[model samples]
Every structure is written in C-alpha cells, then in structure tokens.
Target: MKTEEVMSYYAHTKIEFNDMFTHRVPATINGMVHHSSTGCCSFVFPLSGQGYFTFDNVRYKLMPGMVLHINNTADIDMKPIGSEGCHYAVIYYDVEETVIAHDPFVISIDDYTTCQRAVEQMMKAFTTPGNISRVQTKAYFMQFISEMLVAHQRSKHVDREDAMSEALAFMRQYYQSGLTVTEVAERFNIERRRFAHLFERYTGINPSNYLIELRIQHAKELMRATDETIASIAEKVGYDDPFYFSRIFKKYTGKAPTAYRQCL
Candidate 1:
C-alpha cells in the first residue's frame, strides 16, 4: 500500500476517540500478509482467538488480552494460531512530543485483566449504533490514547532514579548546544567510562547517540515549521558544518533537509 492509501485508511476508518481517532480492525489470518506502507506504531489487543504477528522477521504469539506493539517502520504479517481466525482491536495515535520524550520505545503491560476490560469498553463504544457522533468519536479516540499511555507507563520495566533525572534535565537544557558525553559525565562528577555505562543502562542508548537523536528531533521540528535555510537549521541544532549535518539528517530521516521541507 502507498503512503497515501495508508493515510486514507486512517482518515476513513470508523474510529472514535476523545482527542484522537481509534481504528478497530477485525482481521482474518491464513496466508502470509504484508503491509506495504510503513505503518505507524500502534497497540494491538486480541479480543478473541489467537494469532502471531511477525515484525522485522521475528514472530510473537498473540493470545487473548495480549497487547502487541507494532513499529511505525515495520511491515506486520499475521497468521492464525489455530484453524479459527483471530479477532483483535488495534488503536493508533500520536502522543504529545513531551510524552514521547519521557517514554521508551517499547512498553509491555503485564496486567492482562485490566487491559481486557479496557478493550471491552472500547469495543462497546465503537460498535454502538448511532451512539457516537463525529465529535464523540474523536473524543473517545483521544481517551483511548490516554488509557494506553497510562497502562504502558504503569507497566514500564526500567526504573530510573537519580542519574536519569539528571540526564533528562541536562538534555532539555543543552540539547541544542552539541554537548558531548565527556562533558555530561564531568558535570555529574563521574568517570567517562562509568557514565557511559550508566547512561546506557538507564536510558537504553549511549549518551552521545541520545544527544544526536535529540538534536535531530529538534531539527525536524524546525524544518517542518520554519522557512530557515538548511545551513541555518544545522547551526541551530549544533552542527556548524552543513555537509556533515545534511549527511546525518539523511541517515536519521531518510531525506535531505530540502526534500523534507518540500514534502511538508
């Protein structure tokens, strides 16, 4: 499927959310399936039956109440576990940047019972005939997004304490200045090697790489909203050399700055 087609699906899908839209798909599994367009990251909960979702060539079995996250850049392939097809509910939405900045990529909810209840409520709201107006549908979708975020945060595996707090504060303040790992470690009064290890342990990425991602993320916002030149945007994001900035931006976002701006 083309990107436009996928977007159209999101637009036309009978979804209901308070602040966002919710898409409920009932799918049958048999042969191999491929989603051509890069799908958005989403939550999938099995309401009945069983299936397996293959992502990036890894297959995960889906049982009742099982919530699976599919990456935005991945193509998902689903296969039924038994002869009977699986029935599932999928919810997709984009949270605020602040929320995403604080959350990890993958969050697993261990409390299946609570998740099942939430799914049932969402299904009830979705299937009720003439009960949801356009505004009500949109509101329910936003509510669903909020519920998913709450559940994911509650079940997050890693716990961050002193170091994580300091790291996040430091990033928010200095992300635009091209701060190095050594500088951050020095500020924390720790050895460079030890700081690297701790940062990775807490945040799941090395300090330097995280800073780079932060810068790129900010640069993307600038690109989308500003008419600034590519060189100027690079400088604002801490890169003085436009060539190197362009290369890194392409590597991160799969397009040159000009191309990205044009698309927007």
Candidate 2:
C-alpha cells in the first residue's frame, strides 16, 4: 500500500509452497540473513510484529494478517519494519506445481479468512513434527495456496471490468468495419494472447466470438430496418462473401437470411 515499488514484485512467480517453517525472528536482527539463492520462492506471514521486502528497488510493507511472495528469480531484500523484530512464518518452496492462478505478491487476511486459517494450520503442522501426516501436510499447503489464488483473482475482477467494457464498446463501434480480435487487442496495446485471456475472464466469451455475435446482430437489424439485399447487408456488416455470411448467420440463428426476413 502507498508504494509503486511493491507492485513490481508481483510480476513473477511459479508459486507452490515448499521448505516451510515458523521462525520468530528476534528484534536484535534486521531481516532474514538471506544469501543469494537460485530457483526458489519465499512466502512470509507475520504472526506478530511487522516487516517489508525491498523488491525491484521498492519497499513493500508487510504486517500480520497478510502474506507476501518473494520470487527467487531476482535479488530480494527483506527487513522488519520496527525494532521489536518480527515473529513470522515463512515457506521456502522451489518446485512450481502446474496450477492456474493469478499472482498477487501481497494478500490481506481480512477478506480471506480461509487463507488466514490455512496459514495458521500450516504453521502448526510444520512445527508439530510428530503430529504431521503426509497427506494432511500436503492438503494444508495446497489449500492455502488455492485460497490465495482465489483471493487474487477476486481482487482483480473489478479492475478487469473496465478494460472489458472498453473492449466491448470498441467491438460494437467497429464490428461493421472488418475488425478482428487481434486488432481490438492491439488498440488497447495488449498482446493478442493476453487480451483474449482477460477478455474471456471478464465476459465469459472469446473476443472473436463476441465480435461475430455483434456482426450477426447488426445484420439482423439491417434485415428488419430496411429492405437491404443479403449481399449488401453482408458487405455492410464486414463480410465480403454473401454465401459465407449466410452460412454463419444460419449457424448462429438456425435460419437463412430470406427465411429470417420472412419471419419478421
């Protein structure tokens, strides 16, 4: 919060928790005595006290009731915020399990009680060596990460909505001008692959499919509003081939252009 440097840390991840344990870092020490490492990731949860990570030359604050992710792909610096030192739980996981997730470097515990509970449970499981079961341990770790992913996705939905609406508006205006999904994405300066992903995430429809629906809807309006020829209507709606347009229209509406017009 209140920091731009903190956001850059969220850009990288292969998150799947490992080498986890509870460490009550003393106030006498600054931060973790971390040396250079490779192919690793760190997650921090403060049980008490406060701390922050210096990532990408920017400091991101961390406190109790929150989680932080520090990817090992780059150099990272972490420090406790106050002299009281920090009592926190940390997970040093290296293996990246294949999972569909949104990477949010920081998570607030307030809105996600399930994740908060998962952290506490995992901490206890890791510390209570004799009481740990392999199945239960894996279950807790997976559950915590799963909840975190859910929280991250939920948090971003609002921000994604504005972009989705703009994409829809662009499609509505340009559907008749022979626009493609890739072109629509380029107008927003987003790559085609990512644009399609986010577009579907927000609208539940692929960008290309949405454009097709728009074109068909416009063609229907033309058929109803005026006595336009099928070929002319097809051309006006961005289809140069009347036969192809008719096929597409029938595929979507289950009626040929003439039959649809007769229905009206």
Candidate 3:
C-alpha cells in the first residue's frame, strides 16, 4: 500500500491500548508460530537481532528499523535469523470493529531511537499497578504511534528531495552524452512518464526541455571560447546533425548557431 493510505488509515482509526509485553527468543529457535486469538491487534517493534514474521501469508523482514501491525486474527509465524536471540516488544490494543484491519502491514522508520524510548515508557507504565499507570501507558503508546507516522512522512519528504537533487546532478554530468528522458529515468529505475513528471515538478520544466536548454547553454559557452565549426559544436553538445542543431538554436535564441556565434 502507499504511504499516504497507511498514514490516512492510522489517522482515521480509533484504538485503545489493552496490554504490552517484551519477548526474547533464542537464536537457534526456528519455525515458531504464534496466533493472536485473543481478539486484540498487536504492534511489534524489534529492538535487537534479526528475524522474519509471516502474517496472512505475507512475510516481513524484522529488524531494528521496522514496525509491524497485525490484525487480531492473523496467524503470525516468527523465526530468528541472527546470531543472537531476537529481543522485541509487542503492544496489544483493541480497535473499533469498523476500523479493524483487513490486512496487516509493516512500516519502515529511519528514526528508531525515539520509538525505543516511547516503548520503554509504555512497558514501565504497563507493569505499574494503578489506574493512573494504565492511562499513562495508553498516552505513551499513542505518542509513539504519532511520532512514528510523523517521522515516516518527514523521512519520505527528505528522500524525495534528495532523489531530486541526485537526479539533477546526474543530468548535469551526462547532459553531453546524448541522454534522453527515458535513458536518464532508467538510470534511477523510475518509470519514464513519472520521472518526467517529477523532474518537471522539481525544476519547473520537463526533462526534454531542460536537456535542450542545458545543451544550448553549454553550446553558447563553447561558441564564445572556441573556433570550432557548427557541426563540431553540435556534436560536442550531443546533437549529431548540425542543421538540426541550428534549427533548435534558432528556436531558442531566434538566431542560427553561426549567427549567434558571430554576435558572441
């Protein structure tokens, strides 16, 4: 599912904390299956070691940076894959029947330190013997979820911006290599159309237009600095045919390459 959908689901759903516990499994343990038949959903947070959880036939790799939400009726199978035992915390909660999960999912978080602190507070409150501790436990659990969601959103935004910066750098480096929108997008493993859309959104111009503008800009620089022929200049800027390059140069600058160079 998309990140937006996951964030929306959590934002709209109502939940009440029931209880929480910590589990430690040996490294040699394998093929251990646990089913949640107690009519309560669970949020699993791994603190250390590595493992895998298979729920509803979907396998999720478990590590320090991931959190999983499983519905009450899921058949969860756990296996430790690290050299040491897996140490994790599980928070059980009840959601409104109308908002109950139809499919379990995993969330990847880059910042786990804050989550660890929240879970530790929840664990302390859960073990305390008082009505006030119960309330505190729920508050801490809610805060943890809220922080996780916000962090996910923030990290995603930063990632998109970083990817855009990298894409721009890639274009600048390869602009003279006869690069196409499709070729540049393929370098980043993005779909051609989506890549074009994102590039335009980030740069205020489509990839093809940006490439042309970039090549022309460099061509103008070369025209001023060198005595190369128009055809040679065209090839240097990634265009094979000088006549085609002249037409484009005219379109962008209202003058042919030779005329533009003479003015330069």
Candidate 4:
C-alpha cells in the first residue's frame, strides 16, 4: 500500500501508556502522523506486517520482529508498505532528565537480537487482554531499556579500550617523530604485514588511519590549550608542512586549524 493510505489506518488506532496516556487506533492501510511529546519517549513494536518510518527526514523500513524507539523530541511519520497493513504496539512513559542523562548512548535495536526479543515480548504483554498489570508493564519496559543500555555500554568499553591501548602506546613512543608502519611493527617485534592486520583488527581502522586520528586529536588539544601558531602545532604533531596538516585536519574534522582553534 502507499504510505498515505497506510497513515489513514494509523489515525484510527488506540495508543496507551501506563500512568501516561492510552490510545486505541483502528487498522487501516493509509497515512500516519505523530507529534513530539515532552513527557516521554515512545517505543513502537511491529508485531505483524511491514511499514516504514520517517525520522528527522530519514526513512527507515519497519519489518515484523522489529522494535523502534522514537525520542520525545523527534517528529515521526509512517505508513504501511504493501497489501498487508501494519500492526504496532506502542508505549509511552514520562522520562526524568536524570534518566535521560544517564543514557548517553543512543540505543539501536539493529545490533542486539536479544533486545529485539525483549521488545516483542513487551508488545505481546501489552496486546494480551488483561494479561499484564500496569506496574508489571512499566517494569518490563524499563528492564528492556536498561538491558539495551548495558549492552551498549559494554560494547563501547571494549571498543574504546582496544583503540586507546594501541593508539596511546604508539603515540607515547613516536608522537614527536612520526614512525612508519614498518618502524612501528619492528618496535613491537612483529612482522610489518601482521602488525598492520593486528592494528586494524583491534582499532577498527588501519594503522595509518589510526595514526592520523591520534595526531589530529592531539592537535585539537594543543590548539585549544596553547597559544601556539598553526605552523608550530603542525610541526609538533610530526607534520613538517602546515598546509599538509591543515588538509588532514579538515578532512577529519571538517574545519581548518584556525577555525577549529577559534571555536575553543
């Protein structure tokens, strides 16, 4: 079905959030419109059929067994995709600023399959007649969010540690005089080819790219904290030519040295 047609069905459905707001919607194959709410975020689960959602002007296709989190401040538009209409279980709850603050990472259901299952189960609880108490439903919803946050934090920690260890080690020893990949490999007592492979495996970037990131990160620090000229900063970061340094900096940060320094 066309998106506009799907939205028409969405207009008739009921939506409810425990201790929040409840709404019932009728099934349709037409257009759907959503407005931003200040009190809480919305969790949408597609139990059956297919649809598509638009957020911040980006379209994301929704399939069965998928859970979508719409932020409190985001505008959402959606509609069904084909002949079958979409069925969604939605829940909204007030979120304290402190709770939001604790969640620095944006949780994406795409990564973890376990979190997807949790959302499906929550939808099932909501759809079943008199199957879940208000308190139970709230607890289950919070538990699902908590689990996703925990998994995200764990994954980030692993990635950060791996990147920091290799990058920092390389920087501390060779920051003043830039070392080639072969030199770094020799220093670490490994073959050059293997060293490149290992560095990419651990850092999610090749050795050369990681080196550039390290240099640029340090350059930003110096630019903000010191009154050094761009030329001096470039030299200190192992780039002899300030122009070359500016090019690399702009590539990574989308700003020139002077503009980046001015921002700080």
Q: Which digits, one per residue and each the tens of the lDDT, describe model 4 over residues 1-264? A: 222332332334333345322222334544675645455566665655555667677766554323456656666566754435565555675543322322111232223556655656665566656745544665667666656555544443344345346445755546544545654554333457876787777767888887787789889989988999999888777687899999999999999999988888
In candidate 2, the residue pairs with backbone N, CA or C atoms under 3 Å apart (3 or more residues apart, or in different chains) clash, namely 18-93
Candidate 3 lDDT over 94-161, as tens digits, reads 88863535688767665778888899999999899999998899999999898878766655554555
Q: How close is candidate 1 to the true structure, as a TM-score?
A: 0.39
| Top-TM-score candidate index | 3
User: In order, what lDDT does every prediction score?
Assistant: 0.59, 0.67, 0.78, 0.58
TM-score of 2: 0.43
Runs of candidate 4 with Cα error greater than 4 angstroms are: 1-28, 33-38, 98-132, 146-264
The worst-scoring run of ten residues by lDDT in candidate 4 lies at 98-107
Candidate RMSDs in Å, in order, are 19.2, 19.5, 15.1, 18.5
Which one wins on lDDT? 3
Clashing pairs in 3: none
Ranking by lDDT: 3, 2, 1, 4
Q: What does the lDDT come to for candidate 4?
A: 0.58
- Show where candidate 2 strays beyond 4 Å: 1-17, 28-32, 35-38, 74-76, 96-104, 128-132, 152-264
User: Ten residues in a row with the worst lDDT in model 3?
Assistant: 154-163
